[model samples]
Target: MMERKLVFGVAVGVAVGACVVAAVVVGRRVKSRSKWKRVVRVLEEFEVAGDTPVRRLRQVVDAMAVEMHAGLASEGGSKLKMLLTYVDNLPNGSEKGTFYALDLGGTNFRVLRVHLGGQRSLSLEHDVERQPIPEHLMTGTSEDLFDFIASSLKDFVEKADDPDQLVARRKELGFTFSFPVKHASASSGVLIKWTKGFSIEDMVGQDAAESLQQAIDRIGLDMRVSVLINDTLGTLAVGHYQDPDTVAAVIIGTGTNACYLERTDAIIKCQGLLTTSGSMVINMEWGNFWTSHLPRTTYDIDLDVDSPNPNEQGFEKMISGMYLGDIVRRVILRISQESDVLGPASTRLLMPFILRTPSMAAMHEDSSPDLTEVARTLEDILEITDTPLKVRKLVVKICDIVTRRAARLAAAGIVGILKKIGRDGSNGIAGGRSRTDIKLRRTVAIEGSLYTSYTMFREYLHEALVEILGEETAPHVILKATEDGSGIGAALLAASYSS
Candidate 1:
């Protein structure tokens, strides 16, 4: 009886131990479920916040048009700096001359010599030399930076095939300085501020064309800075050179901006301004554009707060290539913080901009059955390994949400430009005109990697345009891609305005 009792007690203890183990296992599964639920909630919230339904996009379009009008009405009237570029004539291919162009937009600058053959589109020749700006020079003195550019321009000109052209007459150059410039003339513009990693204090409020001219003189180069324009104008010039119907130019690249041909009378700030064609190009520094209609989320807020320039380039932060990947990163980081589904907290995910836009695009466009590209990108960039198929799918959804919003917002902006010109067929949101009454063939010159290289982005933008303008009206508005606008287009402008 004593032996049996001992055996029964031992068996009971063993049974109790097994039951505790099972309870713990069940508890862990429940906890995992809870964590995953939180992750899903976060994603759902992001999606809802980022939703750009047709109605909301139309609001954005109207807001953009209003801001454009306000900006054109007066300086400092709105966030949009409707700066005038006194370009009365868009090049019609009648320009026949050997002109030089110096493009200083991003980290790299290029010098080009373009030879235009009096006729249209038949004989335009160019030779380009590109050089990366040195790191120290970006923050260096204005004189030093200009001197470096002038030195490069000197070297580029020495190798030209037709040296006689330089000796026969003073070389005219169009300076495509892709920065915020406030000026009154086509030949010169004052640097309002520097963007694209340049911060030359002395250059601010100073004439950029004059600085370049002074440098050219110091370096013994015989070149005249004939026209001062940004890359947007360059794109417009190049686009109009190819097709006269191109009325506006848009840049959807690392940075975002647009310039459009507007009637001289429409610019109310400069009331008596006159142009030969009765039209002028207005640089809509649309990157700094902001209105309450824009959809802002926690991710965008955090990204902007952490950015070097907070409260600036608000629209650019949402739509430009520079900030898109980082925005996606912020979303993924939040998800990781909320759940262990993505495995142990990836330290790299905490880092900013480690996952670039190209990588994000790769992940978003992954079409494999198993989403192998998404898996690889996560592994390679974020150091998150072995993500299950479901997790990969979730990542893809995040990318789509972010990119789709950006593309749609960009499309709204395009429509806003059309509306400002009375070519969008909406007639300033009154919507009273018949299709034929407002139907017009309008072409917008677009340049940059976002529109040309990213297929998904391009498609989404096109889709939004169709949704906004409808099938019949959308067909009339064209988004044509213009190449080498900053390089060759500037050369063409120099020829047109050359002395």
Candidate 2:
């Protein structure tokens, strides 16, 4: 009797212990669900705040047009720096010559030579050589950097068709300096500041073209730096060379900027602004553009606050490839902090910019039923492990939301340019004619990894354009991607402005 009683007590204790363990497990699951709900609420709020409805996009378009007008009216009238390019005429395929181009924008620099065949030729023949800059030269003196560039150019020229022939005549070259520049002419610009890991202090506030020209002379290479342009102008030049309909160029790569042909009379900032064609390309430094109409979110505000150049390049922070990944990361970080859905290693999400745009794109584009890529990206980049399938879906949703906003905003920017120049279906500020009255075909040249590589981004951008312009007027507008636009276009401009 005693043995049986003892056995009963042990069984009861074991069963009770099991019950308690089961209840604890249930409590944990309930807590997890609550946390998940909180995260979803955050996401929902972000989505609502991030939405750029067609109505709102139109507002953005209008604001952009107004800002452009203000900037063109005076030097300091608005945030948009509508600087003049002094390019009176674009290359019309009548240019026939061998011209050289030097490209210095970021970590790497390139040299390209273009051979044009004139009116009878179908295409321009061009050759390009690219090399990485030594780490030390980026922080070195202005002379050191230019001398390295001049040396590289000299070697490339000697290896080409005729070293003696090249030396026989002064070669015209175009310098595509993709940095902050204040141009004095088509062929001359003062460096505003160095960016992209370059720390050449002496180059600031100096003539970029003159520096290159001096370097060319030092190497005994008789070359003239004919035009100083940014990558956007290069894209424009290349687009026009290929298609005369192209009037504007936009660069949406690691950075974003735009330039368009504007009427000389409209550039009121320059009292006597004159061009042979009555139009000159204006660099709208569109990155600095700002307006209350933009559907800004808390993410944008935080990003701007944390960035090196706060309150600057506001538009870029919201739409550029460089910041897109960071935005997604911030979203995920918020989720991780509020929930255990992503597992125990959530601390890794704290790193800033650890998630690159390319990685975010990979996750977004993953088409597998199980979303293996998304899972792998999370594990690899954020050290997040064993995330549920729904969590992966949530990540995809966040990427879509962020990317769609950027694409739509960029579309509004493009339409704004149209509105400013009377190319938008609607009449200009005066609103005299129907949007359909202007039937001329317009092409916008675009270059960059964002538009060319990201399929979804391109689709969203196109959809927004159609929505903003309506189906009737949207057909007349074309966004053309220019490959090697910067290098080849620079060479073409050199030929057009050749002495």
Local accuracy of candidate 1 as per-residue lDDT tens digits, 268-320: 99999988899999999899999888889999999989988899989999999
* Clash count per candidate: 0, 1
- Residue pairs with colliding backbones in model 2 are 425-435
Q: What is the C-alpha local distance difference test score of candidate 1? A: 0.90
The local distance difference test score of model 2 is 0.89
| TM-score (all chains, Cα) for each model | 0.91, 0.93
RMSD of each: 3.0, 2.7
Candidate 2 local lDDT, 1-499, one digit each (tens)? 9999999999999999999999999999899789889889989999999999999999999999999999999988999999888876788788887899999988999999888878623356778899899999999988999999999999988878755446588888989998889988999999988889999999999999999899889989989999998889988998898889888999887789999998888889897876779999999999999999888889889889999999999999888899999999998887777776777846668887899999999999999998999999998889998888999999999999999999999999999998888888788763555756668789999999999999999999999999999998899999999877679889989999998
Give the best candidate by TM-score: 2
